[model samples]
Target: MQYINFLPCEWNNDHGFTQEIFAIAIKNNIGIGNPDTVPYRKSQMKNSYQFLHKYKADINTITIAVQEPDYTYTNPKTSKKFTQAELYDFDKNYIGANIIFWNIQQPQFDSVLKFFANN
Candidate 1:
């Protein structure tokens, strides 16, 4: 499944996250966490929630402000251009790295919002 990463930045509260990502999860009825949110919220929510170490299955999956070709991207770390399918596959399989989408145009952004909002 194609997903628009609403949780783009981690740790910094000034980043356009926390609220947006939580809103998305609330809307989608899905749960999410990250390097930043995990530590920050875990302590506060410990009494009511349980924290799990299931992130090895998915490392850092953040979308850059830009998108590459066909709304796809080139792996900044590898300088390799991977198709959407390939990228998602890489995300699932690669356990020790990060994937960033570069040069994203508005259309791609729209498609992402549509997928997230309507799906």
Candidate 2:
């Protein structure tokens, strides 16, 4: 089974935990996720893509999750209790090499394993 560590872009600048996760993945020969890169605008996406691509990792194993902009549900009357569908449409439109949806609630671990097992 392949394991891809999901790393948010916000944590890229602060590589404390991110680096640790990356190190573990590298040591184990697992994959890594670059979700933050997909959210970048046109100009920024290029650099983000470059940075991730330079890792020389297996692109097919990478995953990216994008949240929807209007994915919010508040209480009917009170301003309490709410949930948002963090996976956005753009998240599904990533053209990066081997990018797949890494839904926050439903990660691809089980599905990916099942796919490979079935194959």
Most accurate candidate by lDDT: 2
- TM-scores, all models, native as reference: 0.24, 0.35
Off by over 4 Å in 2: 1-15, 34-38, 41-51, 56-60, 70-97, 102-119
Query: 55-115 in candidate 1: lDDT tens per residue?
Result: 3233233322223343343444556654444434433333222434433466556655554
Per-residue lDDT value at 82 in model 1: 43
Clashes of each: 6, 4
lDDT of 1 at 112: 51
lDDT accuracy of residue 64 in candidate 2: 52
Model 1 misplaced regions, further than 4 Å:
1-12, 15-17, 20-72, 90-119
